[model samples]
Target: MELQKTSNGHHDLSPDRIPENGSPVTRFDALENITEGDTFLPNKSNGKIETQFTDFVGKTSFGMSIFNLSNAILGSGILGLAYAMANTGIILFVLLLTSMAILSAYSIHLLLKSAGVVGIRAYEQLGNRAFGRPGKILAASIITLNNIGAMSSYLFIVKIELPHIIQGLLPDNSDYWFVDGRYLIIIISVLVILPLALMKRLGYLGYTSGFSLSCMVFFLISVIYKKFVTECPEEHSYNKTVPTESIYNSTDGMCEAKLITINPQTAFTIPIIAFAFVCHPEVLPIYTELKNPSKKRMQKVANISILTMFVMYLVTAIFGYLTFYGNVKSELLEMYSKKDTLMLCVRLAVLIAVTLTVPVVLFPIRRAVLQLLFPDKPFHWVRHISIAVCLLFLVNLLVIFVPNIRDIFGFIGATSAPSLIFILPGIFYICIVPEEQEPLKSRPKIQAIAFVTLGFIFMIMSITFIIIEWVTGKKTSGGH
Candidate 1:
């Protein structure tokens, strides 16, 4: 038997064991063994070696991996950012956004570092290795919650904007059932989202993702274009049911962009920013798929993706906020005149992009549910179909009942965003990386511990603020 090097610098005990080469098996070596159709068992098998080996044997290129990760980072969060800027003024928003982007990149570093040590790529698997089944469950739960929030946010956009698009298309102002976003969401979900979600594999949607991201680019360009064209004192009305103290309550002076602004609603700024950068769950998967998946290479992929999104997000928020200033609603596009031909096209693009994206986002949540409930079972269509149906049902309910898109963004950002981007990755790194390689007292581990602490603090503070808002019956006017 080929003996593996143990942490103690000795060969592991085994029958007919060969002498160790004094080097622990690398992830590439393990991958190579699996490539040769051999079982790539680690020095200490977590009973998930096969799953890890099979799932990560990818052939995707570096450029493709970058594209995949960048797409993951790009989502409906873009819609709320201008509102985030509205709440936290331009200077503060830029600082907060910049800080979150840096922290997100750092968090990915910790995750990649931990994964390299264990030769495991899956996020939940790292959790399992670190803290067993409970860890696995917690990781899966966080991913499910995060993705469900995302799906809900996307659908919420559909519910809010789809009806308006329909209304704008008709010849007259006569009320139609299809013009009601609530009913429209249901119909679209049944006809469009369900079929797409039901697909056994979403490999065909790569081009769809490209298209969806292109829509966001179109959105950003439109936002920029509107900033120049839209007059400073433009008299715009809220398209949806906005909060009491919104557009009508705005003062003439409120038109000027502020260097700093703070209010009760400012508590949500971090959470919203957190929500936008919660692409950590997607990081490892992209790493696994990368052509020459090294921590450094994957780190480069993540850094580039986050940097690109950062520029896009910063510009979008700045220009979007500049366009409406205090008059900007939670959904930036909602700030625009729906009758404007360009704005109409922008709305349709957003609706189509988000509608198609729901199915893609739903995949992870459904997969997590299956992993939690049916860990040992092989693929069965009944279970698959049932889970997808059930997940969509639950998400549809959330999209319908949730007051606005901001709540979805804030709540998930306050909770799962921090966990995925900070808490879990920090904890996983501190726990999974061996003491021999780096002790608990080491700088890296110390930083990771601090990272976990920061996440907890952010979560507790944001949740407290949100609860206070609920108790006082003061909703932040981010969306209808």
Candidate 2:
């Protein structure tokens, strides 16, 4: 594959050919040339390219795009925010959250600028453009790992929450097979998730994503409601055994909110924030589907979506932390009394939301794997079904053996989240943006270099701290 020069003198890695009409080409021209494994190549057989921009025109409106991007931003990570706030105090948590939100928006700006320059909308295509096939594989692999971590976290939620929900709804509180979380996760994966994942297309899942967002809204409202009605030193139950240090005897210092906190556990704070703000993978797809796509317009959609999620995340963390303070569990829903009627409803809604979302998250991981392993192969039912099954099976095993959900949030957030939100965008911008437009020492390129450096530092520091904690046998339940 040779690099083709665009009319503007920018080198385009896209395989799109020019139309006979001699009009300017857009990213849509590249979309026309997408091949198996999400890679593209020039169609040498036909000397002329087809103009199909009208077919995709005006398909997605601005309001709808905002909704979709918001849905992508929100995930199981919200359940961990209160725990994050507990480790870091209110002021520090808010500062970190605000910075992450702004940084996420800025990274999206970088991505949009790079994509526009190369006339390539796909994330992996941008990788290919920037650093060739190895870059493409690296991008796909990080996406796969990031999303597998997402799926594992979702299933982990199901493992912890589903049984309590089942036990709550039953007549007898005695131990039963139906109330075993491991068994329930496996069963649900087979019965519910597998079938949905096997489908050829997921246009219908958009409705489910909207429903999930609604459920999260209810969850936020419930958290806020509990803050007013529930007081400190209140009765809270733990589903798992906790250490003596975890128990609170008085409301004296425990309930008092701190302005800032310094502890080993605080290392997980930024990663958790990173995990919550990762909607980058979905951003370009939303841009592609937008009615009138432009770098500025899509940036607006991203900003609105990130700002809305930022508010939601901050409010949820504050209320949830205030309601339980230092006693809150990593999984916020687990900290409440299992018999609480309102909480049961919240658990059911959360279970439904996360369960349905696993298949959606699985789609990207499967695509990345296929793109890497089966790049040139045509669609085959056997391959599709096999990959979905293997992924679910692996995630189920991960959920069953993992000691707690915090590890998932910490490790995944430390690794994949930074790569997606910081490292990749920074590299793409630095490499794909022509030096003529922005010189090596220019503000944008220097900022991009610093951004990549920051990502590497964060990843190394977080991982080192987590490993030290594990080695010292300091692993505990909840955020700490």
Best by lDDT: 2
Best by TM-score: 1
Cα lDDT listed for each candidate: 0.71, 0.73
Model 2: how far residue 70 lies from native, Å: 2.5
Instruction: Give lDDT tens digits, candidate 2, residues 1-480.
Output: 344442112233443333434344454444333321132343234786432221123357787778767777888778888878877778888999999898899899999888776555567767877776888789888888778877887788788778778778885864778888889999999999999889754334566667777888888899999999988653443212322222233322566665675555677556667657887777765665677677788899899989999999999999998988867777788677788999899889877877877877777677667656765465678888999999999988888887765565557656877799889999999987767668999999999999999888878876876777677866533321
| Model 1 CA lDDT for position 24 | 47
lDDT of 1 by residue, 67-155 (tens): 66777788877888888887777778899988989999999999887776555466776776577678879998888878877777778
Angstrom error of the Cα, residue 175, model 1: value is 3.8
- Lowest summed lDDT window (length 10), candidate 2: 238-247
Error of 1 at 2 (Å): 16
Where does model 1 exceed 4 Å of error? Answer: 1-56, 198-204, 234-252, 378-385, 400-413, 477-480
TM-score of each: 0.81, 0.80
